[model samples]
Target: MTWSSALKKTARDGLTIERTRLEPLLALRGAAGVAIVVGLLLAFGTPKLAVSSAFGAFAAGVATFQRTWRPRVTLAVVVAVGLGASTFLGYLAAPHHAVFVALLAVWTLLAGMAWAVGPVSGLVATQTIAVMLVTVTLPTSVVGAAHHAALIVFGGLVQALLVVLVPIRRWGRQRDALADALAAEADYARRLRHDPTARFDPQPLMDARDAAELTRRQARYRPGQLAGPRGVAERLRPVLASLADPVLGAPAEGPERDRVRDLLGAAATVLDAVARAIRRGEPVRLPPEAMAVLEVPESGPLLSGPARRSALRLIALLGDVVEASDEPVRTTGPATEQERRDLLRPSVPRLVPVALRAVRREARWSSPIARHAVRVSAVSCAGYLLAAGLPLGHGYWAPMTSVMVMRPDFARTYERGVARFAGTLVGVGVGGVVTAFLHPGVYVSAALAVLCIGLLYLLMRTGYSVTSACIGAYVVFLLGIAGEGWSQTVQARLALTLLGGLLAMAAYAVFPAWETPRLRDRLAGWLRANGEYALAVLAVYARPAERKARRVREALLDSRAARREWEDASARARKEPVRHRGLSRSAERAAEAALATMGRVTMLMEAHLPDRQAAASPGAEEFASALRAALPDAIAAIRERARPDWSGPRRALAEWQRREGDTGVAVRGAELLTDALDELSEGLAAPRRGRAGRGAGRG
Candidate 1:
């Protein structure tokens, strides 16, 4: 696709705003949790001591607000441990500037590299850094540090209790995930009903299923329990995949086709209804008409073919799910019970081994996350020194901003820096007016803190700007409760925040990992995967008895995943400031065209039911070999920036087509596929020896 067309497609399907009704409930829960913790501390202890309690509550609220109880427990444990360590580190290093900078740098490096594992691990590590920096100003000896640490743990415990005791929506995240997966399947089926040759992207549905499964595993439900909607959703997944097949979806047009479409349409409606009912914890109530659509005659003019047979099976599956609503929950464990038991049994210590393994895995010099970690550590250390040397009141804010704004990619880092600075400025202005005018007491300040924190949680996913603004307001009210004046705090924070943003931007400038350089490898990977998938499909036609349906399916999935990765890489590369001039636009277009043609070839191969006799057709194996060889040459040509001859593959395809008794569809698919290969080869024949081009920026 051209740049303009790609942008339009992205606007249509890429940027989606998810509207979750439970945001209000989550916000309320987070606020109430903080309020309860603060209220108890004020009732039992002095106002000054309540600061520790507030910190604890805030940590717990942030950690477990959206997670289920089981993950909540683990996350709470980690937060408490990290908070304790942070307090100790701060206390130990605060007495000496040199010692503090050294320790902070080490922590920042480790925390930044933790991002390699995943987003959750990254969050935990970053939060630990934030807590340590924020609490470094507290006057604490060894004994006092231990006391503060205990209070922080107590605060997290209180938050956990609030979540467990006052959940607004039971299993909300899990239910929503499952509901979304089912809903996506229904949508895909609906599309197939209208157009058999429609292109289906499996990533969204797969992602939903993966999320739901993760939630189910983490939940503290009874072992092997698959109750209510969870079980139904799992059973529906494989059925939905089969229904999406072109062969089943596009039957011969007549009364049979009409009946099949009607059944499918009704089934999609029923699935949607079930998804909603699952989300709301309501009873499943299929309309009477929906059931009647499933009662078509087995031998009538509308129901006597393979298509009707498949439709009957689908209807029967739906009926069984509805009729068997009252049975005990059926568990489909990922592994056998014995295996789970064996793995969990006590053995020799493995913690050190696992830790070493992970370290070795992420220690590579070429790894993006590792390079980013180094950048963060260097910038953080520099920001700290700059802040301390200046007249800034709080030296930690600059380092904190530097750490928070920097992400794995250039675009995200710059975007986040802009959002953080703007949000903090607005927050400081609004907070200054409120604190100076109202001069609220401890109770009122705590209430405001709760409200602001609630807003912060509510807006975090929607937009970084709003979330940052809420965070700023929250910090102001929290300072009020801690007896710090807003006017003094706001100015210092603003200066430090700007410094931090600048430091983040400067770090990226000095040590860049631009995506443009990686596009060649990404495209090559995609071509190789598609080649393997096409070869696998063709191999089935070459030797019918050796064809494995499972292998073919796996190959298709791999190809699709590779294609997605390449597309994402291309988009990110486009956002970079420069592109390799050697990689011309024509080459990019040809690469995409080749992949499109490959898809059509795969589809034709999938639709054809090859017999054992067809395997003996002259030059069939030679044709398959030629197509397989062409893909590597194409990929090599792109990488080396040199053209290869395409005549060999084209001639092989033509010879195979002229051979006696080959199916028309197979011959046509080969011809089109070879033509695409010719185009791709021609596009990549030029050598790389030109100045770089300025990338066309993304919207």
Candidate 2:
């Protein structure tokens, strides 16, 4: 991609307004919490105190919208505690410019590194720094600072308490996550009826796994419908693929293939019902047609041996899903070890060390997170100093805009910069009109600010532009309590916002951590993960054991994560203006396709994994060894931009094919996998061949 094209694409991305589901009830609850905190403060204290404390309430409410695995109350409390701590520290540092700038650099740096944990953690951390930048001006002395901090903490606690007492859609996140996974598989099954080789995105299943993790306390109240179905949906994916694969289960054009398609359709319907049941917290309503399809005898000649077995397994898993839906919610008893293990979350206080450790690990220069930290820190400090040097009174707005808008990637940083500036402009314009025309008193200003906050919550998911507009009005009305009218804010706010946004974009353009340069590394990592999955499954066949079963499960998870990483890199790289250094766009696409094909073949083999007490598959040991040895070399070849050799696997595959006489499902899948690898080798070699041909012509 060229720079011009990249800019054009990012501009459209920035301007694009997504259509999100309307959550009026949830939005109202969040806004009501903010109103409660502000109202109580105004009744007991001054208007300034209420306005300052509103930051904590607003931030806590925003935390609930984060897409994290943590409970809503936990997130709210954690965010509140951070707000209080940041307020105390910021107040102490505000009196001295030097101390404050130093603190800003360090705080923003940590906030940048927080991305290493996840986006939610990073967003929460950055929001604290932005809030600190604004609220520090509210406190005058040490005692005053403590009082302000306590009030902020009180506001957050109020929000958290509302989460507990009101409890809109209790355990809603868990149910939705589990239901989404089933829904994804249902969709996949429907797609496979037409495209037998359709690839399944593992994101939903991964989300389901994350949702299933529960603390002992949480587990005691676990809803039974959420349980059992997660694992069943997970195991069903491979069997569905296996049953649909022409090489594994059916003829390319025959009655068996038709039956396979029909089975997939029925599976999709059944799974969809289960998903709806789980989502609605109702009993499983099995569709009559799907039940009839499942009840069909597997003794027919349409499917034989392993094919028939896959069909039976699919039905059994579907039955398990239906049975589990009827289970009553469990309200008592100790959580199982399987439910608690590493999935058990530490309390918020203990979580700080874990977060700190993760940030420290990403502090090295090679980490993109570290580079982002450096970028934000420098941009924030520069924006603040520049704003201060000029006549812009509220200099914090500059650095606050930079901090909130900047992200780790070029696309987001640039897109958000443009979006934030435009949003703030529109936001301030509306706010100026309201204050100039209405001239609301202190109580009315508070009411208008609360209304703005409510709209901010309501429109948050619509797009950043809409939310930014509301935030603009919110700030205007909020500071009105301190007697800063529209005239004082109109000029300074818009100018400083533009300055900060420009600074953030320039910082990224000058020091970008381009994903294009690392495309080969990402591809190699994916290849290694794919090989590990294939080898794990083959090892189970070579020598079945309970340990290998666990290994296979772990490998499957690792491979899915790796696949997501590669896909993300590819997507980011395409948007980047930087030229691909080692891997061309065509080669990248082909390599990804080949890898996906190989993965599907491996999954088909895994669908018929031998029982622990059963005899090992013939020649499984040789094939596993050969494939295992080839993977490291293949990964190395990928990194070097050379053709990968898989002769050993090919030899073993041929021998196994001949030994198996009739060519079993595993042997056939292995042949397909090797064919996919051959395609991968050709893809990696094409760029080299192109360059060589050009060199020869020049010579």
Candidate 3:
């Protein structure tokens, strides 16, 4: 090759490399800016502080990246209060050999306290540990610790203030993000629709599913902790609900219905993809084929005039903004009336009630019982430490911290316990080695400190297992610095850690904070919520209007979430050999029935309103009333296990469905509603029959 050509090629390759590398580096720089500000504040502020301000600042950065914060002011206040209180406590308990140890204890205690309140509590606890280790370890005296704590606090507060005050021009970006997700979903749906025989592709679909799941999970955290972007799940809920509706089944011989359905499905896929991308902390990317499909302008009443214009504009903006920001978009954009209508169009039969149920599922994770369990576990850990009378060092604080940090699930608790025990043993052993060979000095200690930080940052970024190993290494280093003989120190530290792990495990498993048993109750609640949402949707559908359909779609999303949660809980429960089989089976059946109900509801809604352009009919009103009335009884059946009596509503719906005249459409809807009611009745009865069959088989 010629030298000039070679040089040009090299330049092109270098530019590509630089671009790829720079994006992440820039993101990191943004993170570091937040950390530096926090570090500076810690270096100067609060004397004898336990937890560091840098932690809070870093947390603010994380929250910003997550785009979770809503009502930014509230988030800022909560963060400030939590960090300040932890710092103050640390400052008050300074000047002792075990001051750092005490700080760990305080952090765990506070975090546990927060977890009891909600998921945000756990996040706060994690931030506390990260900040304190970074900011406080350098100081030798209580006074120095306090000053560092103040500096850290200042840094965090500044970061929070900046985030709150900064007016990001995100509307265009958000709109673009939504559009991208919609376009992707539409393309996926079109592919699926066309293939007819194609099964769901687990890989691509998994990412989208994960994204939706993550959005729902993250929503449990305090509003301001992450960017308060409108989630893809929320945005696409209406569309998905419409698709699930039975009334909108196999499109009649018309291009409009087909086109709209494809668009709605594509939107669902895109939302799922966008949600997943955000959760993974990556920029959203559209599938090329899907993008190509979306670009095509298929003529249809659905894509005509203003509605079509709005969708195209929305999609174009989403593509442009997502490309420009280089960050995952948050759900902050306002929903347009047309966009909202498209979302709410009850194409899927019986969608209103089903969607409501799905949304209610989303709400279940934030329920009081779940929050209580986390809190009680935290309190229990603290109580164990105080009762043991173990010295205020790694021995007392490590175990307590573990309990507060571990998830409410048994599997997570078990893994964390094992990791904690192993890490403690290894760390103590390493500490002994260092103490025996190299005397603890300023240089050795400083080297160890830096090593600890590097290990923590790296391992934590990787996964839980690596993080456990790093924790172990850190503890060993810390013990060596405590001026003890190698053998004796190692033995003592190991024994203490074992005790702490046991106590933590006990606290997690014990009463006043039981998690496993509560799964059943949570499932029950989800079912009840699903029923309520379904009823609401039915009421809205009775009056043929876009607004009512939108409500129905929202409710269906809630039901879907509930079903997903129930499935997760059931899977977890089954993993335990000692799990209550009876309860598990009952919960599973309830979940199944709920899922079926949601699906049926989606179908019914769609059948009633096959075309959005159609005017309301009298029969639509009658069917709506019947659905509303039936919903309460259906819910009661699921919750109370009462047999569903569909005789009255079934007859009314059947008459409407079979009626033939000027109100032929209304009559058809009534017939579908009748079928839906019958199916629901069967669904309610199946669980009981299954239980009986199981019992008979066992006998």
The residue-by-residue lDDT of candidate 2 on 425-474, one tens digit each, is 99899999999999988888888888988888877888787888889988
- What lDDT score is found at residue 197 in candidate 1? 47
Q: Counting only residues 3 or more apart in sequence or on different chains, how many pairs clash (N, Cα, C under 3 Å) in candidate 3?
A: 103
Model 1 CA lDDT for position 358 = 64
Query: Please, what are the lDDT tens digits per residue for candidate 1 over residues 323-416?
Result: 4332333344455444343223211133335545665688887767788889999998899889888886778889888888888667677767
What is the Cα-based TM-score of model 1? Answer: 0.80
Worst 10 residues of 3 by lDDT: 14-23
* Descending-lDDT candidate ranking: 2, 1, 3
- lDDT (tens digit, per residue) of candidate 3 on 1-699: 233443344233222211111224323433453445533433543312212343455445444433332333334445655565555555555335366455555555445444443355356555554444333324444665555555555655665666445534322233334334444544545553444222222223222333322222233331221232344323332333333232333343366457655654555455455555544446666666556545657543445432344346445544543443346334434434453333232222343365445434433435433443444345444644453475533344444445533565544554556666665565556656766687765336434633653444433434344444555555454444444345655665566556655665555556223334555455555655565555554454454455465566556556656656666665555443243423435435544554555444543443334344555555555655666666656556645556556576665665555653423433544454455456545544554564663331100
Spell out the clash pairs found in candidate 2. none
TM-score of 2: 0.96
